[model samples]
Target: MARNDGYEDLGAWSEFGTVSGMVAARTTESLTEAHTGLGDRPDDLDGLPDVTVGVSAAEAIGDLAAELSPPPPKGYDNEVDADGDGTLDDATYRGRADGGVDILVDVDGDGRTDFIGADTDLDNRVDHADYDKDGDGVFEKRMFDDDGDGFLDRSVFLNPGS
Candidate 1:
């Protein structure tokens, strides 16, 4: 198991015989199970060594689904009140260890989520977002990182002609 705590460096290491269920990281700022020391071992490793180097950071921590558990939803204590009503109408869900966050906003204070911003890949950046302009259970605008470069580059409108 390889881990990074954002304060140490990870160098190349060689493994010899029959490596199975190996989670290795080559970056110095990755959050793996080895970093937080929390999570359960995966059940379906194919007996091949897994290396998380130049590929994707998600590849390094994907197996630790149980490790990157998200926290319970709570009130979003920010200053952006879309409806301008004094009461905050947004709630946020964050990861317990990894750097992932999801914010749900009720624009009209109607108890329905009209906007969602998230960093689903744990990259400390908002790479996906959905906007339900009317808060009627359907998103009208969506943006996401189609290339997985940790940036939201693609945008689509659900009702283009509307």
Candidate 2:
């Protein structure tokens, strides 16, 4: 008889809508161990881990998740006519979990952002920003948080064509 590589067993088990109880138990234990290795309290996904060792695992996970997630889709949480131009020139959007905020300005009433400022760490400071500094639609100046430490640590200027 050929050696059973477990695929045959898995296919057989799939017809029953569930794995065997023993397999399920082992799977659960493996998953629990993996979560524990990540410093997470497997029983409570939302609960912070015990931090006697150092930083809580939950905080680390949150920071990583925030960095990995895409920026909030382009939309304004608040709008105001900051330039007395009788049109909404300023738009702001608050970060979902980090309390950060993004501010966008539509300087020419084109419904497109001409300037962008963001506080990625919710520290009441702008950590990243872009500006169309020359009255052009293109953002020529950029401030970025190179270390993810909620500080704008780098600035870049781009030419018109590049």
Candidate 3:
């Protein structure tokens, strides 16, 4: 039901509304299927709205839910071979609501985090990092952005065993 004249307009509007509607429709279908075991009866009709209105309201609520959802996290490319072993290690991504992303890498493949890279300003730049340089499962170095700028302005070193 929405119209767009150009790519920019389309990009600005995105597909959240349509996606939400689809999600709601699927959800409704699943719920209906799950509840079908309850035999049809005239008395049950009084408590529920008409199907069309219920679907419309569900879609509107889905749209609101989609708007409130957070962006998906991003992963690092294969270019970052930190250990120089010519193989990529595993990593996880978390998105910040205000801005940017946080990446946690398991450099040794031991199922523990070894490094964290963050872009707190959403500028596609690394503004902070915490590293477990000794690979002992404890972070020993912290980099920070002091002025809210997309740049690391200070570094603090923690005890090796801490």
Candidate 4:
């Protein structure tokens, strides 16, 4: 027998139907650990497409179902309170499904994210990030961590393409 490799999103619209994908695992443990959110909770399939209803109504019900569902496991492992107001102002998402980590920070607890860092290699270190200085919503510049040392070593101003 051959060892199973892993699974990834195959994109929308396939012969398998919507909300469907291939799972190439022989054991239940492998299927549960695959980042498909199967281990999170049991979904009643209320979001499935209903041909009897109009598209807008079906969409509304699906949105409601999504809102009522619980979040996935290991979604956010790290959190920070920037202003000491007893509320989490920032969070770091160690993505198991996307296979990367993203750190979002709101420096002053003003409810606006001022900085974002991305770890593309899943090494717990940011490779690049966009920064919003002066509390504005627009990201003014970008920084890069060339050595994966958790310290941004390079900076560049954003100007359209560069």
Candidate 5:
């Protein structure tokens, strides 16, 4: 008799007619550990460890369900402070369902806003304090990260990319 290999079930298009992808991650811990000692071991999915310590397949099932759950709207992780003044805007917050665009705009029509868009860094909500050493329009964007953090996240360049 041949040993039963794990199975994968996939689904497309939710019942409500919305686009969705579903994947069932199944593993047999007892089977995986038992097979490792055998000379004629069946194929195993290495990406997912067969023996998840004491973690049962039931737990993995719940995790799969959570992963299959619909994704949240964009910038869901970003804590926006449109009302930096401790107030909420009457206009509906229009954050994207993807985490790409996380920008805050003045919603209350108040002239006093946090960090001018051109300022980039919200230091004092103004651009004058930034290193505009060259008096050029593209200030500080050319700065390099000597520490190599993939950004000018810290420190400033005097005349980078000039």
Candidate 6:
């Protein structure tokens, strides 16, 4: 038994001796196979085992079917892992049901600054300027020249309610 066992089974050391009747009991399979090879032992008397298999982890749990137990399902909390990085931002692991969090970060301390909503364009742009974005008073917005004519074109507006 020791020769054929692999640690993957984890039964040899768990239940070393005495039949545990576990579904993973390798000894049972071996004994069943050996019965066929008993070969000319006798045709009159009932055949019995010369040795008994050992117990298994399944038997330790008082469940002979433990050996055949399937693995538990691994699930996910989308709200917990919105970023899917397997980590949380802070020690407060409060799993929220919302997709994202809302926070305020004032980089310039102007008393009113929303990083995500700040004007990316510097053309005195508040929200929809294709040129001079970044709000630094510079025309880095690259005036939308879709036709390469160096000018702005049709505006893309947003209906907040929509």
Give RMSD to native, each candidate: 22.6, 16.5, 24.1, 22.2, 23.1, 27.0
| TM values, all candidates | 0.36, 0.33, 0.39, 0.43, 0.18, 0.14
Off by over 4 Å in 3: 1-90, 144-154, 159-162
- Compare candidates 1 and 5 on TM-score and give the better one: 1
Candidate 4 has a TM-score of 0.43
Clashes in model 2: which pairs?
A: none
* Candidate 6 residue lDDT tens string, 46-141: 565443366433234423232434322223121211122565222111111232222112223333221221122222212222222233322232
Ten contiguous residues with the weakest lDDT in model 3:
75-84
Q: Which stretches of candidate 4 lie over 4 Å from their true place?
A: 1-89, 92-98, 160-162
Q: List runs of model 2 lying over 4 Å from the truth.
A: 1-89, 94-99, 144-154, 159-161
lDDT of 1 at 117: 67
lDDT (10s digit) by residue, model 2, range 1-162? 222554554455464545477687788877844544567436756677555665455446535755765565454344434343666555645354555666666666654566667765555455677867655456688978777764567878866458
lDDT of 1 at 108: 63
Q: Residue 64 in model 5: shift from native, Å?
A: 0.8
lDDT of each: 0.57, 0.60, 0.62, 0.60, 0.35, 0.31
Query: How does candidate 1 fare on TM-score?
Result: 0.36
lDDT string, candidate 3, 1-162, tens digits: 345644444543467766888998899977845555657755654776545643444345534554675654444332233343777546555666755666667787665567777766556556777877777656789977677755567989967445
Better of 3 and 4 by TM-score: 4
| Model 6 / residue 43 / CA error / Å | 99
Candidate closest to the true structure, highest TM-score: 4
* Stretches > 4 Å off in candidate 5: 1-48, 73-162
lDDT of 4 by residue, 5-69 (tens): 45455545443553243343344446644555546766567987545553455346534654654
Winner by lDDT: 3
lDDT of 1 by residue, 1-162 (tens): 344445333433323221322433334236543444556778667977666466444334433543566663353333233333666555545454444566566676665567666765555445677888775567799888778765568889978887
- In model 5, where is the ten-residue run with the lowest total lDDT? 115-124
